[model samples]
Target: MNGAGTKRRIGIGIVGCGGIAQSHAAALKRLEQAGECTVVGCADLVEEKAKGLAEKFELPSWYADARRLIDRPDVEAITVCTNPPFHVPATLMAAERGKHTIVEKPMTMDLAEADRAIEATRKANVRFGVIFMRRFWPGAQRARKAIDDGKLGDRLILGDCILKWTRRQAYYRDPWRGTWAGENGAALVNQAVHALDMFLWLMAPAGQLETVYGKWANLTHPYIEAEDNAVAALRWANGALGVLSVSISTDPQLGARITVTGDKGATVSVTEHPEGRFGLNDVWTIPGEEEEMGRLYERELQEGREHFKPFPIAHFWQLQDFLAAIREGRDPLVTGEEGRRSIELIEAIRLSTESGAEVKLPLRTSTWVPPTRR
Candidate 1:
């Protein structure tokens, strides 16, 4: 309905009013300024929270039920910023309403939910995209280019490295901060998803994941259903391997990073952190592929675009891309199936932790239990 005339601005609704919703609202405002979108309304179980964001963004309306927001006449696109549990229902709601979507990553808690949502989107013929912004970072771009350019040589292994980060006793005091039903899986699902997604994308592994071995503990913060610490091993389809190291118990907070190794060399990585009030900074470091990396970095620097690279780049890039798909009619860079694959891999890793065995990739779970918000 956005293309009513010539290049009409898109109408977007926000389906969650939590902390992440603020970012989506801000991003929507930026898109509005760029003449790409118009913020129509937002919804939250907490009515005041929805009203506050609506007032802050000067949105035309607000709702308590996400289904209501998705059903609005003016909203042609939607950003689902709810916690993990709400992803699938909200996704189906948007698709059923015929609106485009930009849902946040890890996509959902289980592979089953992801599968259903992705299939529904496919059936609806809508432009559904996920938020895997690390792939957009200047450094990530350089790394991807290096791999694509054969500078990194045949893909080898991607070491998924991340320091356990800042969730103190006080941080989990909210009650829902550290729980399984609330936050779902441990460090792997909540914290390292960004890195996991980046690793898979960069390595470009050919084979399905052969196995995963994992361990988890309340080693630090104990008030949660999920583990505060965890580690895993991944053997890729192409015989490439990955090491997953992360813990939520690392006090004082640290950044998440990844090192992708190829036939040629290694590429050090930096996960983008929130920068001031503007954006994020996800950086990449390819040890020897500096020439190509330098060219891309220098070009961005000259463009005076130190705006948020990586995550936020993917933010703007995907938003624009989804909008373009909505307008010109194209497929998104990261499709629903791609998003589902990440969930399936996550399920495999989680299964490894529970079953104490190597779970295969394209993890089949006829017994996969979907999340039901209690």
Candidate 2:
């Protein structure tokens, strides 16, 4: 419905059958049942993984090579759930075939690959999107609206993003888990990326960011090569200051949250406690609406619980948007360009860490890579 205009169900294909791919498959299963889309096939470098996902979801086909799955005549769109290294390549494959593509977060390891992915999709004239599913959360939407509506006042004073979560040493048993070439940077690029994207999106009204200075270290998890903790300070063109603190070493895991304060002396926050759950407005102080905070939070928390009981509704909602965009000939909410912004921020942080100097916005293209660690 939703302006889809009675068209046939879109055929969907998936690349990379990892843990995240399972979530996508489960979400696609629901869409298939609703007659909105059908899972045509799935693929992974490991034959067993590809076969297992296909058998689990009862998808029509499975392939050991992503290109084979992308070649399927029925698949009109594909979701790339591969490792960071494969994201751009798989997107290029899908774009070459005129298939719409939606990639997982941290669009690419660096800005150059991000630009290439954007250009390829643009030149091919196909829709390209990144999976920032949390953006669909009710609280995140509300926070954005508050800023846009001036409820938080004219000039934003501060933006804070905090993500403190635990990952046991065993979690890195997989050879690729913490490697720069495999998962990219650990805490900031993989775990904290969702919150960081939300922070950037919420602060868009504050004008462009001017500079970033960052520090990172493998404070714990000696078994891994990537940083387990990182922090960055940022300044925006509008003179707003921001801080990002992320770590995978917290023992009890504090979860993820983003808070913003405006010159109106009002502050608001959206939090995802225990992680992976729907976010709720944990803090709201918008003049007359102060009293409604508790009620609104409780209501949304219960709704999120009920909605997510079926499947990860955030992924479902975002996938629905991608499919609807295809049907309506419009761009998905998280376009390749929108996704590129988060990667740019991550890159700036890394550059700052290496150079021990503040990095400026709209970073110039470079072949810089993180130093190898064992």
Candidate 3:
């Protein structure tokens, strides 16, 4: 029990031993070192992979099958770090066994799976959360605060999410990297979803999502089936018109940036460079309000520097939030439902591309159309 007055250490397990699992293992190690939790178990389809990560993280046990890890008596909670295809199954196994579950992003391949995961966790009476760590960034937090507090004025006039991350052809060499079925959609669904999630967060997900138009191109990497770039124009629920441009095609990979403009002629923007790591390179605030907001941003930086490792500090922050929510017996900061909204939005964008027409929200088409050559 990590509740306010309790000191019980939560025993946690890592379900997949892939590349991203390393980050989760490192985070759990940090928590273990702080006396907050322990990494008791690890699992992967490849026995060697599981064994290697367990040895690396100093975890006590490893399993070739996820069920073995889930069925373990000591694992009170589990983080589903499996590939996108396995997210739901892994999480369902954990929740049904009465273990709190944390799922990685894109929650599931689509909204239906996401809803099922949410319902199953609810029925099992276990806490459920999704990893969208970018939401925990300091500049993002301040921007959200300003919007909620009306510092950005009553209406958002414009918003743009520009994510230009680079990946060589070698990056997609894995079977899952650029495949339609294995990795789901291309740039919009894979790389840009995080930025899109941020856009939806700063805006809000409910209400009518209108005028969604998108086009995807395979510009580079002819060996792969998925598009390297995509552009979408849409109207957010709040009636804020915006454009989201994402690509892994850029040569140098520009920073992931989000700029929101309000009716009051004020704009709040945050640009984070891939090389610069987690801290924002530019947290542009309205001129007169900088003294007040800059202090707030500085405080976030100070706390982050004090409590976190240099790289991927946001993951640790979000993981702490999940633990605290479990302890308090409350919903996590980013619930499964909240995480699904971004997938829903992206799916709508894809559906628009497929039909070559503007699609409506609560997308009627459940079909997934992978980005392929024309």
Candidate 4:
């Protein structure tokens, strides 16, 4: 209903049947039920994963190789859920086959690959979207609205974000995760990326970042070649300063949070998952306009929860936006170019850590891969 019409359902497929694939599968099923699309097939390097996902989502076919799925005439679009390195390659494959693509976050290993992927989609004339689902969250939407309405005044002064989620050593046992080459980076790029994106979105109008410096360490999980914790401080061109901290070593998983302060004495904060409660906004406050903003956020959060239960509502909304973008011949909510911001920020953090000096705005080089040292 959000797109052209229920009668002209878009054909869809998925590649990479990993943990995140479940979310994509469920979202597709919901959209299919709404008659906006059809789940035509799926593919994975592991044949069993593909078969299992196909059966779980009731897809018509499964393939051991993604090329097969891309080649399928019935699959007009695809969701790429592979590792960081495979993102660009798989996306380009789908683009070459004239398929709209929705990629899971981090876009790719580095900016060079991101540029290539964006160019591929542009040349192919297909819709390209990144799954920064937090953008669709009710609290985030309200926060953005408040900022846009001048509630936060002209300039932001401070923004602090922390992602203290826990992942067991066993979780990184997967060969492709928690590795510099495989995941591109650890906490900052992998898990904390959501919070980073949220911070960037909320701190907008604060344009280009002036400097970034950070340090990362493998306090736990020494077997992995990536840091389990990292901290970065940033300065915006608009004179705003922000600090971002991410760690997978939080004992009880504190969840993600961002607190922003503006020069006009207005502040807004969003808590993603307080104490492991899914879809719950633990903190949302605006000094003078607390009552009105609080009530509005509460209402929207409740509505979103009621509309999308069991599965993440944000994912459903993002999928709908993707389909609608394709039908309307427009860019989706999080286009490839827009998605590059978070990656660019992450790379700045990496550069600062490696050089032990503050990295400047409009990063000079795109060649830095995720650090390989543990």
Q: Of the candidates shown, which would achieve the greatest TM-score relative to the real structure?
A: 2
Per-candidate RMSD, Å: 4.2, 1.8, 2.9, 2.6
lDDT by residue for model 2 (1-374), tens: 54655656899999999889999999989888988898999999999999999999899899999988899889999999988889899899888899999999878877788889999999998999999999999899999999999999998989999998888877776688888878777887888889889999999888998899998889888888788898999999899999999999885547889999999988999898877678889999999997787898999888977876668889999999998898887999999989988778888888888889999997757444778742
Reference-based TM-score, model 2: 0.96
Candidate 2, which ten residues in sequence have the lowest lDDT sum? 365-374
List the candidate numbers ranked by TM-score, top first: 2, 4, 3, 1
> Positional deviation of 194 in candidate 3, in angstroms?
1.4
How would you encode candidate 3's per-residue C-alpha lDDT over 1-374 as one tens digit per residue?
Answer: 52485556788999889988988998888888877788898999999999999999899999999998889888888998887899888888888899999988878767778888899999998999989888888778877777777776787878888888887877776688777777675666677778888887877622355667876777876877777888888786778788888888785647688888777878887666652345452555565876776676666656655655555567778888887877778998899878887787777767777779877676633576554423
Top-scoring candidate (lDDT)? 2
RMSD after Cα superposition, model 3: 2.9
**Candidate 1 worst ten-residue window by lDDT:** 273-282
Candidate 2's C-alpha runs over 4 A off are 1-7
lDDT for model 4 comes to: 0.82
The CA root-mean-square deviation of candidate 1, after full C-alpha superposition on the true structure, stands at 4.2
lDDT tens per residue, model 4, 1-374: 43554456889988899888998999989999998899988899999999999999898999999998889888889988887777888889889888999999888757877888899999999999998988887677767787788777788888998988887877776887877768777777788888888898888867787888887778987777777898999999989999998889885647788878787867787776543333334454556666776676577666655565578667889988998888878999899987888888888877778889998877634656554543
Ordered list by lDDT, greatest first: 2, 4, 3, 1
- Would you estimate the TM-scores of all the predictions? 0.85, 0.96, 0.91, 0.92
Q: Tell me the lDDT of candidate 1.
A: 0.69
Colliding pairs, model 4: none
Query: On lDDT, who's better, 3 or 4?
Result: 4
**By lDDT, is 1 or 4 better?**
4
